[model samples]
Target: MAGWEQTRRRHRLVHDVAGDFARNGPRALAAWRPAIETEFGGLDDLLRDVQRRLHTAAEARLDALIEAPPADLDTSVAAVLDEVAEIYPDLRRLLDAHASHPAVAEGTVRFHRSVRTATGVDLTRTRSDRSRYEEKGPVRDRKPVFFARLRPVCGWLH
Candidate 1:
């Protein structure tokens, strides 16, 4: 790809990764809390350390991008952006490294609250799988209620 495309792709990737973490990280932690605690019952200190490091690393990545001056796409800018993308995988891995523990999940209640506030959607709404699907006959509609609800949260017509 061209240099500009590479830079744009990196920025997009960062945006995607951060959003994912912000949105799902809490639930992931909450979902597996029991297992996390079970496996590391005596490691609260370690888990806290890991969580702190992970948060710091994520912040550092954002800080780097935020501190960067706006520049028109160019070869140098592309290189820097690519370098930033290079750390994406590592950041993801770190953020999720302690996801196997129950304590982390328990700890994520606060995180989930913050994310919900920022996104303006309750986690229950997004995480729910309680909707049932019904088959529609010919010339009939299916899941009108479910689809209608989805429009408000997902903001689109089905």
Candidate 2:
């Protein structure tokens, strides 16, 4: 935190994590998602995108280093991998917790839609039909939602 500024910040730290990292180069994430649905049709695609983003961010941070390689980079990636390996257990807990609730997911869709319709902060760039990073996949009940899309940028720091 000394030399480097606190360049990035996210409120939904745990949930929008992949979205957070891909802000640095969201084109990478945009290329990966085959589709995006309201209730999240394919968790695998999201998970894969998250993993790829993690790898890309970590590698980019390390590669852009002007100093000698930090002694802990390897160990750090290892530790991160170890924690990511625990993804299933964590996911199981989350799914178990949300299994009984459906509105909670639907509400997420409303939130995005509201952002598109109401926000003063223009997100139009991200939702463009021509965007290379268009969100794709099936939504709840495997029905494709409207063409609503997002490129998932890195916020300001990202």
Candidate 3:
């Protein structure tokens, strides 16, 4: 399967698990509170670190690119844009690494089981079994789009 497809599946699984926990309400939250807080806090810290490093790296590269004015300004601009685009794969790999860590995986499975037991819902069930709880069709679709570039970030800037 494509990388985006795998990423989408992972996100959907997270959403479904969250929904299950939500349905179970406060008690479920209480049961998994520590794990949730720890995991989310860890993720936050990781993101902050990444953001700081990215800022430093981008600044240094941009400074160098500015200092050395290439003959083709458009090509230089494109190179910078391409370099920024390349960061997404690195970020994805970092996330994938964190998700696949043994402790994280084990914790996730344990939490998922707890939520499933609390809610009495089995996400692993076949479509026919799931159909009882989940309505079919696009309206009921929970799968998120991989990437929907519907508009420019700041149209006003243009």
Off by over 4 Å in 3: 1-42, 84-88, 92-158
Q: Write down the lDDT that model 2 would get.
A: 0.33
39-99 in candidate 2: lDDT tens per residue? 2345443443333343333233333222343455433333322232232223222322332
Between which residue pairs do clashes occur in model 1?
A: 29-105, 33-102, 34-102, 36-100, 36-101, 36-102, 37-102
- Model 1 over residues 1-158: C-alpha lDDT tens digits? 59766445433433443444446664544544454454444346435544443434433333343455344323222223223223333333433455557756664555446434543334444421111111111212332212221211111211
What are the RMSDs of all candidates, in order? Answer: 17.7, 19.5, 20.7
Can you give the lDDT of residue 87 in candidate 2?
A: 28
Sorted by lDDT (best first), the order is 3, 1, 2
Per-residue lDDT value at 36 in model 2 = 32
- Misplaced by over 4 Å in model 1 are 1-42, 56-91, 94-97, 121-158
What 10-residue stretch in candidate 1 is worst by lDDT?
Answer: 128-137
Give candidate 1's error at residue 93 in angstroms.
Answer: 3.0
How many collisions per candidate? 7, 8, 0
